[model samples]
Target: MLRRAPRECGSWWWDLDDVTETGLVPALGTAARMAAVLGKHALLEPSSLEWDWFERGRGGLGVHTRLGLMGSRLDDPELAEQARACRPVGHPAAEMSALLVTGPGERLDAEGEPRREPRLVELTVSPDPYGCWAEVAVHHDVWSPCDFGGEPHPAVHANNAPRLAAALRALDALLGVPGEPGEPTYFGVAEGHGLKAPELVDGLGPDLTDLL
Candidate 1:
């Protein structure tokens, strides 16, 4: 089983308010384009989508929905309609909030064998009319220079960080908007197209295994 961090190690956000329209259809379109770039880099394959519903003034209704792709691509013309049809009958006024795109992501294991890990890279897009944005986040330590135990893992970092950076660069080019580094966490921080190196202490990075 894959060990996932309780919170994201690093995240990147893209404000698409100017470039993309805000709505279910347009959000899905953006997700399709973003997923394509991630898939090309073996980051996310987009097998399903999950979201919560909210009303303009009433806030969240605590209602959540999940839709399995069942081999349907995110770009499929029918996907947006299928998603819209899932709205709760009790909350007709509710609108979709941020939609989460999930799928198996490729990760090299202890022996360097590629393994499919679910939710390896999480992608979310907000369809709110007020403002539109998208975010990509990673939890595992593969993108970092050291493991949770403060042990250096240059090989793992080399193999994974570049792929994630390339994917982010591709996403920037595709969306025509540069990604902004998200907030820092105890685990790590996002810098440029990759993670910012944690401050070292006596030649070792911070031991974050306690949080893990």
Candidate 2:
């Protein structure tokens, strides 16, 4: 079964039992590289990463943070240091946390120019030594105008949903696992699976009026 994300934006997630690479730092690097392949312009600086954690039990913990990146600098040394810094100390032997990163993605228009604004797409990873999971969130306003009900315009879905699918494909290639598409969020599923168009749903998700 697919897990529901806390937010109602365009979101997809994966719970991987065999994350070849472990540790928060390594996971961040992998996420950044994947973002780069998706044409993300830059990675959110490490210093800007806001992290929080709490103990769940003896040697168990939970972590959560929203990370941002920009300008395609995944290899920046300083950024790496910041990612390491974000790792909590005295953490449990096992933990689960969602790492979110957002930056500019490549989405061209009919004129072959960028159709979406900078930092419109978001990527997430829930990395753990034993296993991990990840998610992606996109604010519809970043693509186009929405109605009071929070449905993106048809043109917006046409342009952005496919981009989300392509990015998910790239991520799957990296993970070596075909991710199961989650329930349709505010936007839609990213798994193209040979379907025509971006295959958007009929109704709006939870009220995102203020978020838009």
Candidate 3:
């Protein structure tokens, strides 16, 4: 089971169990474990045979998961600290090459023409190890033809599924905020706002092009 405690309160937690696993594609169990820490299901019931809790619907799991991974949320009193220590498969740098992509409400879902106006964020963490795990997202719109190539394509299942779910939770928290995004905004926006993109760069102003 995975739980997220607000960094400040150090008491908040999101439970991940079989329910979360059931909803997730098998390939991404570890990522789902990360996601489990991000949300609570409306209804939870332990399977008699499996003997584990089953949660329904992800709700706000996605964004919080990302925030948890980003580590910035640790500063928020409203957010929770991880119930347990998270030793990642490996250490991940806080910043990457470029842009952050906006999902759902941030972008329009058309069947074609992604380049026409641009439709991805920068520096995402792809769930697929074979693919770029950094540029990952679950927002499967028609515009993207899984062009990026990776394990967990927004809709496809992969080993990093749990991680992707956790990332979503972290991201959701940032969206919940009302004012301007603060400091070192790693993600990118498409031309001010008309279109959305992924977070390609870790720090928008830093310009790590040559350094990276």
Candidate 4:
């Protein structure tokens, strides 16, 4: 089994304010476009949608919902309706917040063999009326130059990093907007299309195995 970091190793963000219209339907449409790019590289195959609810003035109602996609795609018109239908009974004024698109993704094992992992790549999209945005985050070190133990994993990086970079590039092209690297985390930081190389001390990066 692949070891996952307690937090994201790296993440990328896209501001879709100009490219995508503000609304649930438009957000789902954007997700569909993104999923297409990611799926092409076998990064994320969206199978479910999850989100929290919040009222305008009352703030978060602490209610959450998850809808299975089954065989349906993100672009399916009914998906949005299904999501809205899951509204909490008491929170009539509640509205959906950022939607999380999660599913299985492929990663290469130590021997360079492909293995499937659930929620390998997490995608979140905000459908707020004011502005639209999306984020992609990875918790595993497959895209990193070194694993949590500070050990170099050239084979894993070579096998997986390129595919992630390609998907990010494709998403940028498809959305007509470039992706901005998200803030750095303890595990690693995003640099360009991949994780930044750690500053080695005696030819080894920081040992983060304890955190794992």
Candidate 4 structure quality by residue, lDDT tens digits, 1-212: 67898889999999998887999999999988888889888889999999999999888888888899998989899988888889998878789999999999999876888899998998989889988999999999889888888988888999999989999899889988999999998999999998999999998988988888
lDDT of 2: 0.51
Better of 1 and 4 by TM-score: 4
lDDT of 2 by residue, 25-118 (tens): 6666766666665663321222223345544455334466544444435546666566556656665333445565654444544344554344
Candidate maximizing TM-score: 4
Please give the distance, in angstroms, between residue 129's alpha carbon in candidate 2 and its true position after superposition. 2.5
- The list of candidate 3 runs beyond 4 A from truth reads 1-80, 85-105, 109-135, 145-212
- Model 1, span 1-212: residue lDDT tens: 55688999999999998999988788888999999999999999999999998888899999899999999988687998899999999988889989999999998755667878889999999888888999999999999999888888888888888999999999999999999999999888999999998888898999988877
- Could you tell me which residue pairs clash in candidate 4? none
Q: Can you give the TM-score per candidate against the true fold?
A: 0.95, 0.59, 0.17, 0.97
Clashing pairs in 1: none
After superposition, candidate 1 runs with Cα above 4 Å error:
109-112
Candidate 2 lDDT score at position 121: 56
After the best TM-score superposition of candidate 2, give how far the Cα of residue 62 lies from its true spot, in angstroms. 11
Query: What TM-score would candidate 3 get against the native?
Result: 0.17
List CA RMSD, all candidates: 1.4, 6.7, 18.8, 1.0
Cα lDDT tens digits for candidate 3, 27-70 = 13333232332223101111110011111332221211222223
